[model samples]
Target: MLRGVCTALAAVSATGALMACRSPHEPAPLTVRVDAGSVRGIAKGEARQFLGIPYAQPPTGALRWTLPREPRPWSGVKDVGKPGKDCAQGSPGPKNPSSEDCLYVNVTAPREHHGSLPVMVWLHGGGFTQGSGKDYDAVRLATEGKAVVVTVNYRLGMFGYLGLPGLAGSGDFGFADQIAALRWARRNASAFGGDPRNVTVFGQSAGAMSTCALLTSPAARGLFDKAVISSGSCGLRWPAGGLFPGAPADRPYVPVAQGQDDGLAAAEELDCTGAGALACLRGKTTAELLPHSPSFADHLAYGTRLLPRDPAVALRAGAFAHVPVLIGGTRDEARSFVAGAIQYDPELITARTYPRLLKEAFGRHAGRVAARYPLSRFPSAGLAWATVLTDASWACSTLAGARDLAARTTVYSYEFADEDAPNVNGLHVPDVPQGAAHATDLPYLFDLGGRDLLVNRERKGLARTMVGYWSAFARTGDPNHRGAPRWRPGTAPLSLAPGAIRTVDAAAEHDCGFWATTAR
Candidate 1:
């Protein structure tokens, strides 16, 4: 078997750990003992899936707004065949129920036991507001990639990210949970036939944003060796009305003081003010605090012990962890956002309102911006506005951040350019053809919502190619091997599509030079 011979030699690490090969006479075990307890997972096709093992204690009551602690040990074998409830969310849908006791990690590995296989840890994307590690099925990533893949569930919204004044772990409870997951991975990976030393942390959307925070956070040092950031670089910024019609100009993170102020506001609204506000807030039921959750959506704070400054600033000053990075976003990244805005108010942005929208976003540079991205080039006003945001806010910011990372460390930037990419977003507009928008690249790598989004053979082939690229990257820092085209890091991204994968001149294509002058 491949695990017995080929992987035996490949499993050798710098520290000279024991070989990851299974002895020919030894049988694979159905149950494994981890730090917490013995867990028995199911055999999922060609992979072993251990689902919903707690890495941290539940952050309920006195634990709210505090750093994560190691899980209390158990005495008996735990059945981890199914996922736990996702962290308590602001919006718990019929399909996606959640709870506060949701700090679980799911592990998927090739069925054949290989002790030294590379590790890929996935952090899910839901705007730091909602999402669970269970939402992504990583069996393919584990079996095909020949790696151990772990998807994590961290606290979400106010439950995970409250920055009360004088609080100890202000604005970093969520990030702390991620670090704790890494700690668990490091401690238990070898038992799962994974190389803890060769872990690569990757995520999309707000998960990607958290990965950005992970790179810049002092407390997260040595947790992982490589990073894959998708769609949510620290440098990504939305101008006023760029995200949606009335959305404010913002980045994912805020100042600590700002977060504290929002926290206090929540306290006053809930009538939990004064010296014991933290305790009072903690004592409130989850239902009582759900409404104020959205306010902390993009409010991960800086100037705290976890993150000293903005990750964008940290990258510019070369203060981030010196790890190889794979970063980029989809081509038409903002069509989904604009499409949603138009869905709410069909007349919110027509030909008549497009110019006014530009003025509100770009201010003095509105005319120049209009001239550069004219309505004649696009199908509808919403599509045109989406293009403006795709270029100015999404593409350019990602490219610039990639450039910064390449200057400091190795970077392989890519743009998932399949125009007919699957719409994993689940938001549809008759006018907006979701062509490679935002998280459309996700399904190419992960089976999102526990279902494969790729339907056709060509897209499935592209998914295979992407898995090859990603798994190879997980195996080694560089994502290059035979049978795939060469991927080089530079200012622009390597375009990822079904048949025509190649390099692209993104600055010229996106009018980044014009936005460079106009951007605030």
Candidate 2:
């Protein structure tokens, strides 16, 4: 119904051109013909944006939990003026919309580009439970970096990663959707003036974890030429008394048998049993299914034909895509989590409960952890706890993964160290001085909802530098460019702070030696 109205307006405007008359000063209409059909996009400044382009058929009803298939070719021009609905998940914000039919990708390209430009495909992060590709506006990256950018939407939660026994390839539907999007990009990038062979896949947090998974996934071997993993790594194993106790810190991969067991338990709880279980499950409404679905943050089943082994294990064996990788995390990644805990329970910041908390988290290594991260050293017990976990779970583990990746291919590591980086909206918790915490670097590249907060000259410069480095990496495998400082690989990670960008020994700075010893 909505599309019909748009099509009627297009037909009235002109015979073939699906756009209203505009002033001569205005930019021309943006349209690109792809495999499925021709899509009409919007022109903003010097960039052409095609939003909400479906790469696969809707994964709803009988198609639920199944691998994504190519979207049926449409006869008329598709109106890609706005973003499509995000995959079904808990509401990320009051304004965010989601649905089951959410396998879409958005493309942004420079309007004045000559030949094919490098393409950067982005994946959003929300712990695999929330977030949509539309949250990021890539106009800045497209115009300033002189590259074509693609943001993607894949299924989340039960719709994306339900691991039932009867349903083959159930848990990996999201990964498959991503691969399908890449295949679409490979086939249609030329329409948008993008080089399919020079595609770079980049993401942050859970998105970065997905990128790491793609590196090891047999199905994604040749889909991307390079990768940028931010604030996440694939080699981390949940430590005994670490940030997420009992959870795997690496790219969480569950065995097929374990996944099937969990799926059966979930089905039993939902009262969907016997031969009609899948039918019953699929028939349930979104409201009924949301409360019963397992936590989306849990690991997906690996060791299948799609993903043959754990990502970390596969990386160690050099059984992954040998693409150049840029990997790193923020300096105080755990501060935000610790600040939230302290806000909920003030006793978490008290010295009296510090050792007890350490014991609860560290198990047998409490004493050693306490000695290394004493309460006297930090401003508060919360800061100390945050520091310890930052080293153990994030910094050291990520560096370890970088080293392994470096052994096989070129690797560039970095640490965002701007202690007073502006906190993004929804993350500005009171009393929490988010010191370049997890995902703080997002604003430096994409113009998110809180782009105005980074208005200062220094922050703007950093954003420009980051965009340059990222775009340069997309153009070539290396991130080096003129005007920016020389970014050496694997020797010392480049420290990115306001007004300063240079190399620093992140391993020594984060006390990786102690973490490495304890991790082993």
Candidate 3:
């Protein structure tokens, strides 16, 4: 059973009345007949929204650990008035309950246009542990960008990612769920007046990691033409995290004594080993084990066909899908993660500790990496740490992915630098201002019907520009527009994280310099 959240319906103006009516007994709203069922959605001011449409069969009992099954045919039109319950995971803040039956999608489209429009499919980030497609609404993005926007809910946590011995495979099942959702879009997007052929997959944080995985996996090769990864990097499979296969005692970072077991080990601890592991886990109740769910970074399973090796290795070997990509990171990308590491104050980030941690993770390259981004050049210890981490984790990873892809594909790179990007959530450290922190770019790309505490009017204008660029990219592989500045692919090392808006040639003016400066 799915849990319910807040629900309300607002009226539309006379000029837009036709877009909001759903039936003759009521009004004529946006009506679309999907393959599994039909939906009637109302126009919410600028955009028409259809919410809570299931894309796959509910994974219950015997269906657990198995691949997603096709959604069952419904007898009548489904009421898609409210967004579905998020995947079965704890919310970051005060929100809703978690459940196992959350494989649904929500779509928003422009009102005036009728033919097949470009579509942007969103995959929410929670490190494959938390977050929901419903948490984000696509009103602003669809209306302003004039493209159909789709947000999806995929499996998460142990239910979604656990790779037991008896399970089907030893990789990311959460990612598999997303691929299934995209398949759903390819099959039924035309009903919503969207062009299935022109699809773009995008996400932030853990969602970005998922995007990177999709780019390399053969299963997701033809699903999307373009991708946008924000604030997450690939490579570095720590033994402690359990994504890779190396002896726990062989790695210094492994804290096996801390009870941080990998999915395999966790299953063993639960007395579930070998082929019957799926059945063993299914017998347990949701309440009996959730209080002790694994951390977001804990890798449920890997070393499978879906992910033959780490994504960074795949990107370097040129084994990924050859698709045009837009990759970027915020100025203060790691502040959120830093904030979560309490007791480790900004002042505590010394030259000794910084290099020590880096050495442990990077080994021989630690000194070289540290030299490129020394703490001595920054304003404060926190700022220096944030800069290096943002660059190393997000900026550099994106640059590497873009540069490698550019050898055979088109790749544009960026670094968002808006400092006062309203972070009223108090999630980041006070010293580490949002400064285009992790996910600040999302609101500008899509209008979810409410003001994100981190945005205002000036920011809203920036949002329009950003959405315009994204929409153009969805329409055509290129992100160029009539009035906007020309976007060039990052082909060289110096141009990886170029200033905010550097022109492909002279005759144009953009803010590429601002991005490059903060990035450095």
Indicate which candidate wins on TM-score. 1
Better of 1 and 2 by lDDT: 1
Residue-by-residue lDDT tens digits, candidate 3, 1-520 = 1111111222322222222223223322476677776677777876778898899988767776577878998866677878887777764334656677888899888766555678889988766777888878777788777788889998877667665444474446677788898888887766666788889998887777778778887878788888877765454232110121121211111122222236567667678777776578788766554543554243534346566655777788888888888776666666655544423454445555666655554556667657766777765545556665555444555555566778878887766666666563356566555566677666666543354543356776666667777888888877777766566767332111212445222101122222233321
Quality of model 3 by C-alpha lDDT: 0.64
- The pairs that clash in candidate 2 are 241-361, 241-362
Output the better candidate (2/3) by lDDT: 2
Where model 1 places Cα greater than 4 Å from the true spot, the runs are 1-21, 24-28, 92-96
Candidate 3: misplaced stretches above 4 Å?
1-29, 91-95, 233-261, 273-276, 295-303, 343-376, 452-455, 491-500, 503-520
Candidate 2 stretches greater than 4 Å from native: 1-29, 91-96, 240-251, 425-432
Tens digit of per-residue lDDT, candidate 2, span 71-121 = 999988999989898888874345755788899999988776445678899
* Model 1 poorest ten-residue lDDT run: 12-21
Model 3 residue 271 lDDT score: 84
In terms of lDDT, the poorest run of 10 residues in model 3 is 244-253
Residue 442 miss distance in model 1 (angstroms): 1.2
The count of backbone overlaps in candidate 2 is 2
